[model samples]
Every structure is written in C-alpha cells, then in structure tokens.
Target: MLRALVFDFDGLIVDTETPLIEAYGDVYREHGVAFDRAEFERQIGHASFAFDPWRAFGAGADREALEQERRAINLARTERQPVLPGIRELIEAASAAGLRLGVASNSSHGWVEGHLRRLGLHGFFSAFGCKGDTPAPKPEPDIYRLVVNALGCRSVESVALEDSAAGVKAALRAGLWVVAIPNAATADHDHDGAHWTVPSAAEVSLPALRARFGG
Candidate 1:
C-alpha cells in the first residue's frame, strides 16, 4: 500500500548527464584541455560541486562564453536523448495503483520542470521539489522532505526511485524506502545503503513496496 512514488530526475528520468558531460568535454577540448574523468566522476549526483573550468585548466577561457557554448551543445544532444527504459512504465503503473507521484531533484526548478514537460511527464507528478524549493539539494534530505510534505504523505509510506548514491542517501535519510536503479553514469555508485537496489527501473514495483513498507 505504498502511498506515493518519488523519482529523481536527471540521470534517472532522462540521461541529461551524458549529454552534459559531453558538452563540458567539448568546451574543454576547444581550449586544448582534456576533461578530467576522475574529477567529473566525483562531481556526479551533486549540484553544488565547484565546476570552474578555468580554475581546473589554468586557462583564460571566459567562463560566461564557455557556459553558453556548453549549454548550446547540451541542448543539441538532449534533443535526441531518450527517456530511460522502464521509466514511463513505472510512472503509469504507480498512477494506476493510486500512488501519488512526485519528483525530487538537485537540479533547478526550471531545468527539471521544463524537461519533465518536454518528456510528457510533468502532469504525472502531484509534487515537484527541486534545489531552490528546499534549503539544500540531494545528499541532503531537504529535497525529499519537501516532496513528502507536499504530497501529504509520511516518509515511511513513500517509495523513492534513485540512480545515484546522493539521491539514495537523501531519500533514506528522509525515511523513505529507497529503490536504487543505476544508469550508465551511476553504475559504479555504491547503493548498499538503500533499502533495495535493483538492476533496472522495471524491477521497481508498487506491490513489492506495499508488501515491505505499506501505505
């Protein structure tokens, strides 16, 4: 009897991560600097990471102009990026089971909301919580707390679908039952802390959730 299902946007909903990383890589390449894979991996799943390309590369690249180019590239790449497998199915299944739907993310409202709508998923959520909506972002429990409160559901009766370690940690801290479903970028993430870790989103089920942590 799970009352609600909360999803993490970005890598979990749509793979904006790959496109964004590619865009960033392009920007670095333009300046004759190779993108640092290790540093990029460390910054994944957290929005507050220091991403000053100039400081990292010791280049005189204009940050604003570089940002604009990166955005343009990302936008072009995202136009063709498809929603992840099992995402739509999960949403529809949850909706049909009378579960209130929500999205909690470390991304900005404009970013997450607009993308959700474009992907034809904005109307499915009863609540949408993002960076500014809470005091902090994922890896902090603020975003998840905001979503649970907005949906008028207790944390114990809600289920969270997350792809990254930060998202899983946040949901667990907020008392939600978490299902970790990693995407390519987050496949190496440590999900041992989650209540359940699944190989794919299709394995996330309301019936299984109710059996474990009822509504």
Candidate 2:
C-alpha cells in the first residue's frame, strides 16, 4: 500500500518553467548569447544541477556570475509565479486522506521555499528535499530516496508524482511507483517506464489515487 506521496516542485507543483526560461533568456542576452528555448526545455528538467545551462550555452561567460544573474531574475519574477491547476486541491485531498507528503526538487532551498510560500504550499510538505540536501539531484535517485527515507516509508509503499523524465527516472530508480504529468514543453519526452501518465493532476482525484494505492 502507498503510505506517502512525494512530488517534484517546479513544473509539477507550480508553473515556473516559462518564467524560468524567460529569466534564463534574459541572462543569456546580457552575455550576448542567444538562448534556445527548445534546447532549454530539453535540458532543464529535474536534473538542472547536473547540467547547468549557463556553462552549456554561456560560452566564455563566468558560470557563477551567470547563475547570480539568473537567480536575481528569478527572484524578481517570483511574484508572478502561478500554482499548477488543481495542485492545491490535490494536496488538500491527499492531506485529508492521511497520506504523508514531501517534496524533492533539483532547485536550491531558497528557490523552492520562495515558490512554495508564494503558492501557500510551504507548510503542506512534511519534508522538503532540495539540491544541496543530497549528494546528487534528480536522475540520480538520491534525493527521492532521501524523501522516502525521511517519510519513514518503504520505497514500495510510496508514490512519486513528477512532470519530467528525469524526475520519473529518479523516483523509479528509488523503487517507488511513479505518476508522470508531462508539461507542455516536455510532453514529447518518453514516459515508457512510468506507472501511469496522466494529462494533469486535476484528472487524478484523491479518492481514485487512494483506491488504487492506499488500500
């Protein structure tokens, strides 16, 4: 039986991908490098720390400087970040159903906390696992494994909801059942190994999830 539900923060819980892409573009423009939206979407999934796009596309630009610029841009745009449709309802339902919940993300703690606070979801998560909280990020399974361990649940008794292939891979590698909800930019990515692929979390009623896994 599934005792906990873990989530990915960015594209999964909140719709921050577009703003993040725009911010990265602004950073690239300042350095005279054109940002490729397609490439950015393809590469900037849950494993962002593993493949920092600043170094990939910045040419001779200083990585630390570029990261600072990106962070500043993101912070400036945080007020405009919006929660994903039905995410709050899903979270509430899951909570009411007595399922333990947590978050695992490739983003830094500040970034994750800021976004979650903006969406009034900061207190919903039982545990928050960020990039620096683990030795490795998404696509490595370490972060997700950490969340499961923290939840005090066995991997087989947990479910992970993610929006990217990297996040799905991480959860699956950690031996948790994974539910994939691909974003508009990453909808074309392969989800062959996910336990289920849903169009959106809105379609997944809490009762249905509980019926499938809680029992």
Candidate 3:
C-alpha cells in the first residue's frame, strides 16, 4: 500500500525557484550586466552548490546592497506565486485516502514551512525533512530517508513527488517511486531518472499514482 507521499518544496510546491533566479537577473539588468541563467540553474535542486552570481559586477560592486535589492525583488515575486497547479488537489486526495504526507527538500525547514503556510497548505503535512535535518540534501537520499522514517514508512511504501533531476535521483536512491513534474524553470532538466514524468501536477491523481506504482 502507498502509506506516504513526500514532496519537494521549491519548484514543486511553489514556483520560488523561478522568482529567485528572476530576481537575480533583475539586479544584473539594473547594473547593465548580463545574467548567466544557465549558471544559476546549477543550483536548482541541491544545496551547498558553489556559485558566485555577483562576480560579473566586478570587485567595486556593492555586494551587500545588490543582494538586498535582489532579495526584495525575489520576495515580491514569490509572494505573488500560488500553490502550483493540482498540488492542492493532490494533497487533499492523498490526505482523504489516509496516506501520510510529508516534505523533503534541500531548503531549510523555515523556508519550506513558511511558503506552505503562506499558501494555506501547511497543515496537510505531517513531517518535514529539510536542510540541516539530515547530513545532506537531495542527490544524497538523506533528506528523503529522514522523512520516510519520520512518516513511519519504508521507502518502498512511499511515493516521492519531485521536479528536478537531482530530486528524482534522491528518491530513486531511497527506493521510492518517483514522479517528476517539472516547473517552467525546470522544464529543461533531464528527468530520465524518475519512474514517470507528467506535464503538471494537474495530471496527477492519488488513485492513478497508486495504481501506477502498485501501491
């Protein structure tokens, strides 16, 4: 039986990833500098990525002020984002079916929880295994394992809903069935590692997922 469902936070639950990248791009644009979108994409689904987005502005640039501006832009854009399509319905259906719901993400617990709460979907989750909760994040299976354990279910008895290649690898490594639903920002990512790929969360249904995964 499918005892649990674990979700990835940023791109999957909310489109925070796109807004964040756009915020950085906006800052770069204001300074008449070009933004390397492909470079920023490297940090999409994992934590502790080594990237220096401000190097293009040269040594004389005010890093602190620029970061502040970028953050403000990001916050404004992020606040306007709604829960991704069909995510709310999928969560509701999974909940009504008595399946445990949880989140496993590379982001900090505060980040994930804050967004979920803002979207009015926080109460549906029972466990959250985020950054600092485990030794490592997605691509390591640490976060996924932590959440599955917290949900009191084996990895095989759970399904992982993800939006990135790294997240798919993590869930697959943890032995859970993975469904990849890439967002606009992640649409170009290679998600061949996932068990299945859907255009959007709207294509997902609890019954169909369980049937596909033998839950």
Clashing residue pairs in candidate 2 are: none
What tens-digit string does per-residue lDDT give for candidate 1 at 55-128? 75656657788889989999999878777888898898889878899999989889888888888988999899
Runs in model 3 lying further than 4 Å from the true structure: none
Task: Write model 3 residue lDDT over 24-63, tens digit each, in one string.
Answer: 9999999999999987877789785577779999999999
Q: Would you estimate the TM-scores of all the predictions? A: 0.93, 0.87, 0.96
Residue 208, candidate 3: C-alpha displacement in angstroms: 0.8
Query: Model 3: how large is the Cα RMSD against the reference?
Result: 1.1
Error of 3 at 193 (Å): 1.8
- lDDT, candidate 2, at 189: 72
Candidate 3: clashing pairs of residues:
none
Q: Regarding lDDT, does 1 or 3 come out ahead?
A: 3
Write the residue-wise lDDT of candidate 2 on 1-215 in tens digits.
86888989888888777677888889888778877777778765665534557765646757787778887897677667678887889898878878889998998889888778877888878888888888878888999889999989998998899888888888899999888998886687777799888999888777777677666
- Winning model by lDDT: 3
Candidate 3 minimal-lDDT segment of 10 residues = 42-51
**How does residue 177 of candidate 3 score in lDDT?**
92
